[model samples]
Target: MGIYGALSSAVTGLRAQAHSLENISGNIANSQTVGYKRMETSFIDLIPDAPLKSQVPGAVLAQSRATNNLQGDIQTSANETYIALNSTGFFVVEPKVGQSDGNSVFAGSNYFTRRGDFEIDKDGLLVNGAGYYLKGLPIDPGTGNISGSVPEVIKLSNAFLPANATTTINYQANLPQLPKTAAYNSTVYNSELLKIDDFVGGSTTASVTGGDVLVGTNPALAPAGPLTAGTSMTIEVNGAPVVFDFYNGGTYSGSGVGIDLSGGKVLDDVLAEMQTGLRNFGGGAAASATVGLNGAGNLEITLGSDYYGTFEVSGAAGVDMGIATGTASSEPTRPDLTTISADKADAFVANSVSGGAITVYASNGAPVNVQMRWAKVDSAAAGGTDMWQMFYLSDSAATGGAPAWTNIGQDYEFGSNGSLVPPGVPTATINNLTVNGVLIGDVELKHETNGVSQFADVNGTVTVSTLNQTGYGAGEFLSVAITDSGRVVATYSNGERIEMAQVVTAQFNGINSLKRLDGGVYQTTSESGEPIFDLSGSGIIGGALESSNTDISDEFTKLIITQQAYSAGTRIVSTADEMLQEALNMVR
Candidate 1:
């Protein structure tokens, strides 16, 4: 029984030394492993009952256990994927198997690990080298809800989508008012008038009876025959009217043949004819009425319903056409022309209810629809452009019929592709114009795709110029770091930081009690307490790995100790065998 006990003890010693050597080898092998921790072996003793007088007892090798308190050095790498736990924590990985509830399987009832080197799979799932999917609170794509079962793997490549394409753009500008002289006018007059009557005749000669006949017998006009009565004739004295008659058979009828005796020129019959001749000698026979000078050279005239007056002869008539004064009537006021020249169409007072539509080109020169609401009406000034208040709407189709004016308190600048230009700016051309909310014209835009570009005012025109170009290239991977909250941040060449995942850390009550599993992993057992959830980088020192705690010198020393122990155990077995052999030989 003693010999058997010695053999058993030697075997136990050899096995324990071998186990210790194996542990040391493991520590040395994984010395460079991130988050790896080294382990040590411990042993217990066993004793059997002894007799009182003999005072001897047999000792037996007992169970060997691993020391779990070792900590390892931490290492860092430039790779963002490389991570280390600052505290006790395990990465939760889910299997591909479906859950009994018919949902996707997660780490809730699955496995855990310390490996954090992960990448996104083709399906945009985050996964590890073993194809195990990392688990996290699931996120809803639409509502961003994070309450469902965690996905197996997170896909990194498909993390971002393209930005929304610009559908429409609005442009507005005031048009220079046209000059006032360009206006047209309208005035007219009557061409013709209506006439009353028409007549054509001359005085007649007839025998006078109880009617007077005026005649003159001068050598210029002598009556070759008997005078006649009822002879109506036009007198030349002051262009007046007169009546005369001649008696038959040379009879002189005083009543019928009477002439003006005021000039002492009278003739009955021939005498009257002679006076008539004298009176009508100087001036020609009158047609209608005439104004002339009398023989006395005094202004003489006939005042009667059918007679007209005559004026004395003069060199020329000086007539004063009355000075006609026009009444001061009000004239419709014309809008200020000079000031209007500088005013843009947008500056006009807009009474239109429906905002106008303006089509503007985007940075890519694509036409975009924009709705412009009336902004303001500013008068033109020297060295300053007339300002107009303009607004835009997000949804033109919904609010186009009646666009509401945006509050002025909000500041607004032309969008990235837009620009403003004053009047007479040669480089800057008017892109669009609106009047009373009416879109009058369109503006052309110039743009560039690369670099930071801005529109600048150049001589009242807009010109797009390059500003700067920094970090404007395809994105590249950059450094990464873990936060105390366990968040993994991956930085990019574009100065963008992405939150990769929350490093999960797990804590077990008795880490030494954990069962070593394949793949440098550990499994939970009844002795090992349940894993307590925590985050990596958190100061909590639970189940987290402290890298390979193996010091090079310490590991080498342990290796020597293990070899010596193995040799000693073998020697003990050899000595026991030799001793037994000797006893057996003596018996023989």
Candidate 2:
């Protein structure tokens, strides 16, 4: 049949040059990753017998279409959890229970991903190093909402406490003038003289008695020599020593001549012994004595040593006793001797009776009273004195009772109350994330169905489920970011950073009717149509990363056209085995 139709058209050009050199070695092995996106390989031609144009030639090697617009080149990573999606997003990931198998879950239904390298598991679950589970919106441990189902476990909450330290002060008062003394001792008198009588008459009248006399006299009063008429007589001052029945109002009955009534009773018994010696003579013996006044106003003493003679005079008629002896300038002067001084040597010279009471003492001997208010001895005011004005009795209304000296102000402050303990463990949030390179995505195919044979629908039997699960720990991979509502944030190494998964783009009304599977994955066939997810990278870009659509110069020009079509299909089976070996060697 033309040598098997020329070896089936050179094995379809060596399987399209080994699928264009495996997509030019996956676009030079991801050309430095970071959101990589360079994919291309597309071809379509397999029309053998069209409805009415059949010249009957065979050629069928169809469908390849991947050219999803290759874009890759973003690189900025000072890692605030490294992100990169200027437009479009995907990352959804949930179907976990024992990762994939089982008719690939009938090929569809929600397991999309663009790897955003997430992390957080030690129960704070936002997982991804193939530990999957990043699906979003179920936040509410207090309203961080989005709405249910992707949470296999991510809980964090509790931390914030620290603040306190400041307060201290104290003070006291009492000090003014402060000094005093006085306890008891009085007995003063040098001349000690005290006598007053402006004029006193027995049965008589003579009034104009205005007198002033203050005397501590006997500084030996000297001035004697006047009033010597009949040596002054007339003293009947009889209050009880009476026996003088001399009824001679004016006629002393001539006693000096013959009326000497027994010498007038011995001169009234020597004038009653000289008036008892001038009343015990003590003002220096009554100032050198000399006195006379008799006619019964008895008091006739001639004692300048008894005046050189015998004397007898009695009832001699001339009764005028008005005793008088003034002239020392009328005496009055004495009160000068007050000495008490102190300005601290334990000052206290007591006797301030103008409103008493004073105690004061505190160099820690505590005893304050001070209450004087008016005391003056001011001997011409230069400390010969007792000047007082004092005040301070405590109940502190600012030095309390009588506090005026400009109200005493200067000193204050006081306060207290404190206690609380138990602030122990907390300190681990370090290094805080920093990746800076290699982060390509777009390889998320997931499937899990085991209902009839059990990879895990449990009762529906068909088993397999245990691929030794358990990964994602060495500070697990987390960096993925992008939110302004097109969600997909991740970030954990303790500094948390949330919003895990919302991105879901997947559109196909006809990406050449989809289907190419083995790893650069794609599926939806039946003339591809029903996939429309939303976050517009226009329905297909999802945080993008397609890469490897191979074009190393069109795969090295299809590897030189598949090595000349595998050397022309081995020369068409060696020219059909050389024409059947010459017709079987001429029929032998």
RMSD (Cα, Å) for all candidates, in order, is 29.8, 39.7
lDDT, candidate 2, residue 217? 23
Predicted candidate 1 versus true structure: per-residue lDDT over 255-274, tens digit per residue: 33243323222222343353
**How well does each candidate superpose onto the true structure, as a TM-score?**
0.43, 0.22
TM-score of 2: 0.22
* True-vs-predicted CA distance for residue 523, candidate 1, Å: 2.6
Q: What is the lDDT of every predicted structure here? A: 0.40, 0.32
Error of model 1, residue 315, in angstroms: 82
In model 1, how many backbone clashes occur? Answer: 58
| Model 2: CA > 4 A from native | 1-90, 93-108, 111-135, 141-147, 150-554, 568-574, 577-581, 584-588
Stretch of 10 with least lDDT, candidate 2:
163-172
